[model samples]
Every structure is written in C-alpha cells, then in structure tokens.
Target: MASTSGSTRPSALIGWRVLALVYDLWPVVAMWMVASLVFTVGYTLSGHASRENIAPFSALQWGLWLVCWLITGAYALLSWRRGGQTLGMRPWRLKVVAADGVSAPGLRALMLRFAVGTASLLLAGSGFWWAWVDRERLTWHDRASGTRMVRLAKR
Candidate 1:
C-alpha cells in the first residue's frame, strides 16, 4: 500500500486566495489609473489635446494602454526574476515558485506569462479562473510560466 503520511496538497482557502488575488492585482490597476490621469491631465494642460482637438484623446488612450502593458510586463518580469514576489504580492506574504520549486523565473517565461495574463483578462477572467480549479491553484500565467504562488516560507 502507498503511504500518504508526508504528502500534502498545495492549496489555499477561498478567502486567502481572494486576499492573494487582491494583493497581487491592486498594483497593476493603480499603475494604469495613475498613468491615465497623468496622460489625460498633462495633454489637456499642454493644449495639445483640448476641446478643440479632442482627437488627441483617442491617440492618448492607445498610447497609455501600450505604456501600461510595458510597465506591467517589466514589473512582472523583474519581480519574478529577482524575488518571486511583485510589490503587491510581497505585502500579502505570497511568492511565486517554479514547479521545480526554484525562486526565480526565466525572462522568456516571464514574458510568456505576462502575455497570457493580458490575454486572459482581455477575455473576461478565464486566466484567473484556472486558479480556482487547478490542483496547484495556478493561474493561466502561472501555468505558462511553470510557477505557483505559495505563502512565503518562515524566516
């Protein structure tokens, strides 16, 4: 008979998972919001995009969207490459680890993960939904990156 004494499941509670989600997502939202405000207000103040030339608003929107994507990608890549925790995630005591349990993620893997994350959110939350059913509770990005989030080990 197979012994199951030491083996344990890797999962977290719905509430902790929610907390983890909030903790991991808020920074990305905040960055986008702040960038939007800066771009809109600055362009309006500069008169480059005023009531008379509101066409610039459309351009500004697309530019800021691209900027947000770059910023998010850089953040995810750097965090995973450095400490396995994004700014928001660290506060919540969560860290991303590879399936093999390594602390750092590769650059290509980070890019792929972030890209899948973008696509997932673009289609309504299916990427995040993967976390709900995955045995290891991995988001689509996590699956792509071959990583999983876990509570930080005690010091």
Candidate 2:
C-alpha cells in the first residue's frame, strides 16, 4: 500500500493506466450485470413477456443504458471519494489526486474526469495516447479535471 503523504509521487504511465482499466473492467461488468438483472425484473413486472429482451434502440433500452452508466459512475465516484484508488488501482498502487499530487480531488473534478474518460474511450483512446506526447504526460481527462494519477512507491 502507498500513503498519500507526500508530493513526490510519480505520475502513472499509460501502461499502468491501461492495466488498471482492464482490471477495473471485471467489477464494472459485474455491476452492469446486476443492473441488467434489475432492469429485466422491472421490465417483466411491467407486463412484458418473460423471454423478451429489451428492444434495441427503444426508449426502455436507452433507459437501461443510462442506468448502467449512472451505476458505473456511482461505483467510480464513490470509490474515488472514499479513497484515491479503486480495486484495480490498489493493485497497481495508482492513486488519483489533485494536480499537485497529494490531496483528494473534488467531486466535480472526478465527474469531469469520468466524462472525459468516456469520450476518450469513444474516440479510440486518442486522449490517452496524447499523454505520450504531452509535456506533462497528462491525458485529456487529467487535464480537464485538474487531477493527476500518481504511481505510489511500494511499501
């Protein structure tokens, strides 16, 4: 474990960030499954047939997508608020903090980070690749949110 005690922590590299994202996918998928189950139950209870799946591009399907998004965001925001790391980040000793590298980022910043990160993914990770050329080695989300991901030294 790493302590958020000093300003000397190194910024996390793209590889570490990608690894954490991959690891985080497991829990996120689990959450999405649970959300899907709830939606399925609600849909069935609303007089829909038991075997019917949410129709593609229908309003109900869109609502389910939105719910899943919110659920994922809640998982991320709450984890970041409670501690600087998510389950995946903990393994890599990655911590999210203010740009100065020692304090927790505010909720607004975390939200911004999440939004931009989604955009980054949608754009085929151009924003993440930008870090390779950025002077500060920051991704779009990091800059937009005024947050930095640091790799803490091993204990």
Please tell me which predicted candidate would have the highest lDDT against the true structure: 2
For model 1, residues 60-152, the per-residue Cα lDDT tens digits are 667887999897788778887888777766665666666665456677777887798789888887887777777666778878877666665
Which regions of candidate 2 are displaced past 4 Å? 1-10
RMSD of 1: 4.4
* TM of each candidate vs. truth: 0.72, 0.90
lDDT for residue 88 in candidate 1, whole number 0-100: 65
lDDT for model 2, please. Answer: 0.88
Instruction: Assess candidate 1 and give its TM-score to the true structure.
Output: 0.72
Task: List per-candidate RMSD values in Å.
Answer: 4.4, 3.2
Name the candidate that leads on TM-score. Answer: 2
Per-residue lDDT of candidate 2, residues 34-73 (tens digit): 9889889999999999998778899988998898889888
